[model samples]
Target: MAPVTNGRVLFNAIPEDYPVPGKTVVYDTTETIDFENVPLNGGILIKVLLLSLDPYMRGRLRAPEIESYMPAFPLGEPLTGGGIGVVLRSENDAVKAGTHVRGWLAHQQYYIAPNLSMLEVIDRDSKLDWSVYIGAAGMPGETAFAGWREYSEAKKGEVAFITTGAGPVGSMVIQIAKQDGVKVIASAGSEEKVKFMREIGADVVFNYKTTDVREVLKKEGPIDIYWDNVGGDTLDAAMEFAAKHSRFIECGQISGYNQGYQPMKNPGLIFAKCMHFHGFLLAVLRPKHSAAFQAEVVPKLVSGEYKFTEDISHGLDKVGDVLLAIQKGTNKGKAIVRVADE
Candidate 1:
């Protein structure tokens, strides 16, 4: 067979603020690969079907010298993240052709999986949509599940405040808390998102763009649990209304991801309120909680008992745009980009 086009999203340059498509990240369509001639080298050739566009990816667009939990994106290379794909050819005995896989995958239509340690073969008989493996049933969903179980010491009838409640992590957090009989007060950036949050079981939902977060919290909250997703000011206000010994699950801070660092206004509240402010890493928690999460949530997802929303964009060109939307809090749900059809 002749060489086929291999489109990819490349990290072109580091950004000071929000990454700009075409400049900071580029959708390059110049590359190609011959299916017949490409060497397997004890690896497998995969056709990527879905790629997750997440808020945390913004942290990866940095100078290589600076270190974090994850490495910076090397310039002039494709971005990589949680993805779902099908193996088209395999030289490795453990991986067979025509099987679906979920793991760290490149931001391209085609990829070569040289290391199989990180890859997990998905069940083909499940009959689930490929997007589910990259969105609702994926990293973002697991992050919410593991984070809540590890941090939230929630009590029945307690008030819980969740910022970014319509998002993948926040949406799941809202439902999980409600199931445990916790009253939830959550916020979103748009009216549509606010409505979605309410439908998913938030006792009180508001548009942060049109309403004041502090005012809403004052009226309905003396929060016992704070599921924090955005950190700058909303976090401060949640602290103001926090019940003594409140548990704070410090997740991603999308608010500060694109801007210069802004210190919290009253961090001393941590001591005064005796708040258990804990930040978590998904990588550390995933291995411990993955099986439990699948057992508990997968059936619910299949039965439509667990509700979710996916803000998906199609094509490799949409990666940068969707990622930018995630940083700005404009996306309605778990941001994803579809690269190919199964």
Candidate 2:
């Protein structure tokens, strides 16, 4: 109804270590997006509702010269990643005002979606919350599905260990394992997260903050699968007692994302344990495996069989701070910023 002045977070500089708000992740306002004007020739204007703050985003905070699976966030550009948005105005027949969408959107109050192909116009009739698309029901959920089902091939009655167990992906791994009758040992940084892991059906949970990770893991684990999220000493311990022919799903390594690559103290166990360690991209399995993930997990979520929690901070201005908290592993659940109301 009125002209919209969008506010967005910009990738100001590459952080040498953890992101420093206003320095590495700067908050800046931008020119108002004219609702009457079409973006990307015939694209739509969207009002971002919820912004997903994920661990993978930390990798993009690096300097541009360094190469990774995805390109580093370019200097002085608006930061972009997965976000939940609502169409404000549309130029295409397929999209219209008031439609909910999930896609790669800037950490801004409003942005232009140049292509609907990169986005999924969510079924408005569904009872699911818009924020769910950015968290467990989104990429992280798909990651858990592919990691445990397609990659790990873990069987019932097997023992598995998941690091950073309170986070979305790791939590899903715990639920999926239990659903398939596998025993899961979950580890997290704090007492609160440890409790969350247990609530989400982790058979055994450990607080890495207090426990000797190596000793505890070696004692509780002859683990058949290690769904790794944090890499460093935790990985070393998983390696030490890995069961024969065990699968190690190398997921997000949050511990090393901010700090430079920290080598494992006992990488030699890869050979001695005969473990299958492979990294994977969930994007590779999109559309095909997406349905299976929804069909399998969404019902459980709705039925309260699969419990989850979300930590939402209000406003678009806090995008940088939330990302910082996610990097530090302080957010108890899915770290998200609610930018606008749906």
Candidate 3:
């Protein structure tokens, strides 16, 4: 009978470099929703519990005219990304009230999903936390799994190098490589992150900020597999020291996402070494590898054999700040915004 506050994080402007919290993205609470009276139209009304803020979202903040893999964020609208929520009302038989769902959701406190095809119904009684679905057990986890399983084919005892190694995807990459007996050399931005990489089983870990990445690679490398997340100078260095017939998984280029395209100093090394360099989209790979990833990884996650670090901040207002932190590689592990407690 009463209207409830429905807060939202809206995209306000296209940033020249990094998005500015409260300016480029604004938190608006002026909107109100009649929760009980809202129309579902053969779908569901959800109370958003959590939202995943990954590095890939940075590319979505550009002008609508600019074409890319994912569509640009429409100005003055709620930003959308991978999130988990609880359904309060449903008009569809497949989805019922009180069920938990995971999918791409608008960055708002509450939303009405008119379509159920993309949204997945998750068990509400699962032991894993809701936030995990948006991070280690979700898209980021899948990306890391696919990258290592399909792209990086380093044999046991061979060295594998992973950039941005403490974050969600890289952390998974590190653990997967270790499980297969591959020696992992990983880099992070801070000492804390370097420590985290070691804890996750990276054989050789270093704070790329303090130690020269190029020098470290030269000593620890001639790497058989290079899983690159930050692709500017670090990638250039990896190319220089990469072993003959090395496999390079070009996952993300967060280092230059805000600064624009960064040219490689020696891309010719790929040809000279007869290396395998591949860039993949998770959307393309998930259909092929998701079932296996879930079956193999989820059990390990539950048993505590595999670890995932989550950097969580609360409130809808924090979405902009979290995304900015992700782009700069400042947040630890998988950065998530806890919108509401489940």
lDDT of each: 0.88, 0.84, 0.89
* Over 4 Å off, model 1: 124-127
In candidate 1, how many clashes are counted? 0
Cα lDDT tens digits for candidate 2, 316-335: 78888888898888897888
Clashing pairs in 2: none
Q: How much lDDT does candidate 2 score? A: 0.84
RMSD of 1: 1.3
Per-model TM-score versus the true fold? 0.97, 0.96, 0.97
Question: What's model 1's TM-score?
Answer: 0.97
Residue 266, model 2: lDDT of 78
Estimate the Cα RMSD of every predicted model relative to the unseen true structure: 1.3, 1.6, 1.2
lDDT of 1 at 258: 90
lDDT of 3: 0.89
Worst 10 residues of 2 by lDDT: 123-132
lDDT of 3 at 52: 90
